[model samples]
Target: MKAWEIQESFGISHLVQVERPDPTPGPYEVVVKMTAMSLNYRDLMMVTGRYNPRQPLPLVPLSDGVGEVISVGAEVTQVQPGDRVAGCFFEHWTCGKPSREALKSSQGGPADGMLMTHKIIHENGVVHVPAYLSDEEAATLPCAAVTAWNALFTEGNLRPGETVLCLGTGGVSVFAAQLALAVGARPIVTSSSDEKLTKLQALGISAGDCINYRNTPDWEESVLSLTDGVGVDHILEVGGAGTLEKSLACVRFGGNIYQIGILAGVTKDMSVIPILRNRVRVQGIYVGDRQSFDAMNAGIAQTKIQPVIDRVFDFEEAPEAFTHIEAAAHVGKICIRV
Candidate 1:
């Protein structure tokens, strides 16, 4: 088996590919031959040693991937050889509330991830993928797509005809937009680039529904205007402290703000007045459990939703893929064909 590792140091240039003995499955385990992988902002941070400086070195660094089941242990009955599956971000989080034990099983950082030609995982840690999606598309689901689904549907309880405010054109935001459209909800997406905003229009978002944040600095006010002063029913707030104030200002009373990331900044001197005043519900969403992943796959299969992939690199170009994501130029997910 071959895999890329962040050996001895953290940085994209330091990623080194090496070989290891192929894995054998234990009882209740399965061996998957990875076909594709995708990049997330967290993956870039992990490689650069910013996500968790205490994380051990020589880690395989990607949480999202899809593969074919080449072998299974004697007791494994959830899936069989030749089945297509996507690895779960948190291998032990099968259902219900997350716990310390479940958090320890998170892939691509604290644990070895699926960046290799072959990976051995518990049968409970992988989900059957939608039949209609290509390997590259299905590979983007583990982290970003599941987080979006958990935020919007599982926690937010997004209803049809309600408005959703997507912060940017990143994987989670774009997936939230697509999922919103799939369920008959309205999506208003904001981007720093007009070019990216134009590209989003092709993905079912209309020009009137897109906001160029560079041109409209007070985009939250624009969101309010678009909603006829009532404000949106749900918000995918990825910008943390730097944008939370504005997010609070635009979300309707009793509306849900699913906090999924801290892309802007982790700390800021912001008021929490609106939170209580407006009776808003701000929930922090981690990636989600296996039951939710299964439900999301079912929706994707029924709706024929296609994940937005910006680029695909060859297996040997893994380091280049990391560099590309570090540049933050992609409109959506960046993938690697393993």
Candidate 2:
């Protein structure tokens, strides 16, 4: 088997491809022949040593992948050999609320990830992919899509005809917009690039009037104007500290804010007055559990929601794919065909 491993706590440059022995499954585990994997901002942070202080060196660095089960261990019945399955980014949280133990069990961090020809995952962590989606599309589901589902449906409780706001055109935001539309909610997406906004509008995503945040600076005013002075029912806050205040300004009174990413930097300082006055509920979302992953797959199957894949790279070009994500050059999920 071939895999990319980080032998030191360095940047993406430290990722090296090497040959390794194929893994065998444990009593409750399954070995998957990886078909595809996707990139996320967290993958870059892991390589740069910016997230998860507990992450050890010599790690595999990806959380999203789809593969075919080639082997299964004893006592495994959830899935069988040759099933098309996608592993949860956080492998231990199968259902309900996440525990401290579940939080500690993550892929592409301290534990090995899916940047390999084969991966052995606990049987409990693997969920069957939607039959309608391709390997490239299913590869995008484990992290970005699941995070969006958790933000809008699980935590935000976003209802049909309600208005939702997404911060940018990145993978999570794009998935958030798509999920909102699937459930009949209106999506207001913001981006610094009007070109990308135009593309978003072409997708039948109403765009709810986009803001060129780079130009407007105080883009929340535009959001207010678009909502006719009422604010959005839910705001997917992916910019972290940089956009927290703006998110506070744009969410409706008694609305929910899903703070899910730190793309703009980690430390955040913002006023609590708006939260207090509006009675806003802010939930910090880690990528969701396996039950949510299964529910999301069902939703995708029902709605036939197509995941937006910006580009696909061959397995040998995995390093370049990581570089492209690091440079923020792609639109949606970037996948590696293994």
Candidate 3:
């Protein structure tokens, strides 16, 4: 087996491809021949020694992947050889609320990720990919897609005709927009670039629905105007402290704000009294549990939803993919085809 390991050092330049012995499955585990993987902003932080400075070195650094089962252990039953599946971001969070133990088992950092040609994982840690999606598309689901689904349907309980405000055109934002459309919710997307905003319009978002935050600095007010001053029903607030205030200002009373990222500035000061006075819900959404992933997959299959992939790099070019994502130029998910 061949894998990219963050050897003795902690930086993208230190990622090295090396040969390793193939993994043998435990009684309840399976071996998958990984076919594709996707990059996340966290992956960049992990490789650059920012996500967790003490994260042990020599780790594989990606959370999302799709693969084909090639072997199953004697007691494994949920999946079998030849089945197509995507790895769960949290291997142990099968259902309900996440536990401390489940967080320890999250892939890409504490666990050996599926950035290689082969991987061994518990049968309970994989979800069958939708038949309508290709490996590259399904590979984007484990982190971004599932997080968006959990933020909206699982927590937000998004309703048709209700409005969703997605902060930007990143992977989670794009997936949220697609999932909103799939569920009949209107999505108001904001991007720093008009070019990126226009690109979203090509993906079935009406020009009226895309807001250039650069042009409209008070984009939250634009969101309010778009919804006739009632404010959006939900806001996918990934920008953290830097944008949390505006998100709070744009939400309807009792609306939910799904806090999923710290891409903007983690240390910036922001007010919290609005969350109390407005009775707004600020749900902290980690990736998601396996049951929710299955539920989201079912909806995805029915809606024939296609993940918006900004670019697909060959497996050997995984490092380049990291650099591309670091540039923050992509409008959606950046993938590595194994």
Lowest-sum lDDT 10-residue window in model 1 = 323-332
Question: Model 1, which residues run further than 4 Å from truth?
Answer: none
Model 3, span 1-338: residue lDDT tens: 99999999898999999999988999999999999999999889889999988899789889899999999999998999999999999888899877799888889998878789998889989999998899999999999999999999998888998899999899999999999988888999999899998888877877898898888899989888888888889999889888999999999999999999998868766678999999999999898999999999999999999898999999899899999999988998999998
Candidate order by decreasing lDDT: 1, 3, 2
- Candidate 1 lands at a TM-score of 0.99
- The Cα RMSD of model 2 versus the native structure comes to 1.2
Winner of 1 and 2 under lDDT: 1
Clashes of 1: 0
Superposed on all Cα atoms, the candidates' RMSDs to the truth, in angstroms, are 0.7, 1.2, 1.0
Instruction: Write down the lDDT that model 2 would get.
Output: 0.89
TM-score top scorer: 1
Angstrom error at residue 302, model 3: 0.4
Candidate 1 lDDT, 91-196, residue by residue in tens: 9999998899999998898999978999998999999999999999999999999999999999988899999999989999999999999999999999999999
Candidate 2: worst 10 consecutive residues by lDDT?
Answer: 202-211
Candidate-wise lDDT, in order: 0.93, 0.89, 0.91
